[model samples]
Target: MTESSALPGLPRRLLADPEMISACASRDFARIFQLAKRRGGFHSSRIARTCELTPSRVGEVISGKRKITNMTVIERIADGLRIPGHLLGLASRDWERAEIPTQPQPNAAMRRLAELQNAHTTVPSRELDDILAIAAGSKVTPTVLRSLQVSIEDYWRRDDEHGGEALRPAVIGQLRYVTGILQDTADPNYRRSLHGIAAELARLTGWTYFDARQYSTARTYFTESLRLAREIDDRTFIADVLACLSLQATYQDRAKDAVTLARAAQDSARLDGGTPRLMAMLSIREAFGHASAHNREATHSAINEAVHHFEHVNPEDHDPTWVQYFDRTKLTVDTGTALGQLGDAAAAEPLIAEALQAEPTTNIRARAFHTFWLARTQLQCSKVELACATATEALDLATIVESPRVLTHLREFRQLLGSHRTIPAAVELVARISETAN
Candidate 1:
C-alpha cells in the first residue's frame, strides 16, 4: 500500500494545517485521528497501516478509549503523516520541501504548506531576530542583573515545590533569553554580573534536567555553567556546580566519578572561603559518594566532618542563596541516605524518618524522595509490610509531583518489591505503578 492509496480521500491540506500540527505535537492523538476520519475522509484501518498500529488500537485511540504515551509511536505517526518534525518537538525533517506548492486557486493544500513552512522555518528566525534586537537595545544595569538573579532564584524555588517537569521548559526559555542578554552586553562589570546570573541559571537548568532524567542535557548545562563560573572566578558557584555534577554522577551509579567530583567541590569550597554551611553541604555529598563506592571508613569520616562543619556554621555568616536549602534536616537526610546506600539500613532508618517528619510541605519532591528511601531502608531491614505501606505513600506523593527523580526512586522501590509480589500490598503497589506508567 502506497501512502496515497492508504490515505484515500484524505486531503493533504488538512494534514499539514498548523493547528493540526500543534495538536499532534501536544499529543492530542485522539483529536487528530478524529479529524482525519471525519474531515479528511480517512479510515482507522488506513491510519493503523500507515502508523504501524493495529486497526483496533487505532479505533480505540480515536474513540478516546486509549492514550498514546509512547514517544517513539508518536514520532512514527508524525512521520507517516508527513507532519513537520519541529511541530512535534523534533528536528526539521530533511524531506520537508523548501518551497510551498503553488496552486492557481489558493486551495487548502497551498495554505497548509505555507503554514508548515512558517511554523518550521520563518517563525524561528523571526523570533531569534526579535530577541537579538531587544537584547541589543537594552542597557545592562545592576538593577537588571539583580532582577534576573531574583527571577532565577524564584524559579528555583518553584521547581523545588512543583518538580522539575513542571518548570523545565520555562527555565530553558529564560536561560536562552539570559544568554542573549549576555551576548549583547558590552560593559565589563555588567557582563560579569550577567555571567554570574547566567551561570546560576545554567546550573538550575542542569539540575532540573537531571531531576527529569535527561542526563546528557543535564551534563551539557552543568559543564557550561562550570566553565562560566570559572571564567568569573566565582569559587562558590564553581563548587556548587561541581556538587551538582557529583549528585548526577551519584544518581547514575558512577561511584568513582561521584567521589572525585564531590571531593573537588569540597576542596574548591575550602579554597574559595566558602561558608561553613556550604563546606558542610559539600562534605555530605562526599559522604554520599564514598557510601556509593562502598568505602565505609571514608564515608564515616566525611559524614563526621560534615557534621562538625555544620555545627560550626555561624548564623551571622553570609551564605549563598543556593545553599539556603541545606540545613540540619537536609544534613541528617543525606547522612542517613548515605548510610542506607552503604547497607547500614538499621542506623539509617530513624534518621531518615526524623528528617522526613521535619521536611517542609513545600518541598514535595524531596518529601517523596525521602519517603522512597525510607521505604527502601525498611525493606532492607526485612520490614516487608511497613516497607510496602511506606512505598505506597511514596508512590501517592510521586503522583502529586512531576519529578522524574522521585519516579526513579519509586522505580527502584518497585524492583525491590518484585521479590515480595506474593504480598497483597506489594501486588497492589506493583499494579499501581504499572497503571501510572501507562
Candidate 2:
C-alpha cells in the first residue's frame, strides 16, 4: 500500500497515531474515561441515559469481541472526545460506506426493532438539522433541543419511577419500530445514522428490564446495544454500556466481572480521551467493585482517581450535548462512601456531609449511597441515634428509586442497626426494610 495508492478517501496520517491502537487495546480507557467524565459530567447511572449507549458494551469493545466498522460511530465517539475526524485518519465518506450487519433474520430483528422505536419516536434528522441550522443562524429562544431533552428524560424515567405495566409494551413498540427502520433503510449510512437511536433504545429496554428485576433480559438488551454501538464505533456509548454491565455484575455479586468490566470501560475512555463524565463513572464503578471485594487500597485509589478527574473538567470543551452528570459533589459522595467502607469514618463523615448538604435533590442517588454509608460511619463512631436516622433515610431513598442496588444497602444498614435493638425506630425501620426485601 503505497502512500499515494492508499484508499482514495483515507487520510495520509490515519495510521500514524498510536492512540487508535491503544483504543482498540482498551489500554487507555481509564484515562479517556476520566477525560469524558470531566467533560460530560456523567455519573454511572446517568451515563447510559445521556450517552444513549449501554454501559456494559464499553467492555465488549475493549475486549475486542465487538468490532467497529462504521465511520459515523467512530466519528460520534471522536466527537464525544472532541477529536477531529481527520485526526482519526478517517476519510470524509468512509462513515457513509461503513458496513454494519443488519440481523440475518430481518423479520425478527425488525419486529423487535420496531417495538423499540415506536416508544420514543421523534422527527427525522433532516427536520432536526434544519431546526438546528435555524437556531445557529438566528436568535431562537424556543429551541426544540431543550424541549426534546426534557421530554426524553421524562419518557426515560416514566416506567422506572412508577410500576406501570401498560406503558412497557408501548415503549417496547417504539423500540421495535426504530430497530425496524434501521434494518429497512437501504442507504449504507443508515446504520451509522441509526446507531444513536439504537443505543438509546437498547439502553431504555435494558433499564426497563433492570428495573423490573429481569436481569437476564436486561443483560441481553445491553449486550445487543453494545454490539450496535461498536458497529457504529461509538466508544463513549460503549463505555456507557459497560458501566451498566458492571452495575449488573456488582448487583449480582459478580465482583470479578464487575472489576473486569470497569477496566474495559476505563480503556474505552482512554482510547478517545473520553468525556470527563465517563471517567468519573468508571472510577466510581471501580470503587464499587473494590469495595464489594473489600479491597480498601484499590477502592481508595479509584476514589482518588475519580476526584482528580472531577477537578479538571471544562464544560465549554465538551460535546455540547449529552454526558453532564459528573460533578465534584457527586465524586465526593462516592469517595466518602468508599472511604467509609474502608473504615475511615473520620474522613468519610465530612465528605458525605458536604455532599448531602450541597444540592440534596440532585444528590438523590448519591444520598442513597451516602446515607447508607453515613449510617455505617455513625455506627462505627457509636452514634446509634444518628446511625438509625441515616439508615431510615437510606431506606426511604431506596424506596423512591426501586433500586435493588440501594435495597441491598438498606439491608446492610438494617443488619447494622438491628444489633442495637434498644431503639424502637431502628427496630421498626429494620422490620420495614426486611419486609420490603422479602
Per-prediction TM-score: 0.71, 0.61
Lowest lDDT 10-residue stretch of candidate 2 = 3-12
Give the top-scoring candidate (TM-score): 1
Query: In candidate 1, what are the lDDT values of residues 16-65, reduced to their tens digit?
Result: 44335435544558878888877776688878877778999998987766
User: In candidate 2, how many Å is residue 91 off?
Assistant: 56
lDDT (0-100) at residue 1 of candidate 1?
A: 53
* lDDT by residue for model 2 (322-400), tens: 3555567777777787678667888888888888888446345456767788888888898888888878787777765
Model 1 bad stretches (over 4 Å): 1-124, 128-136
| Model 1 weakest 10-residue run by lDDT | 123-132
**By lDDT, who's the top model here?**
1
Stretches of model 2 off by over 4 angstroms after superposition: 1-151, 156-170, 188-190, 319-322, 360-366, 435-437
lDDT on C-alpha atoms for all candidate structures: 0.80, 0.62
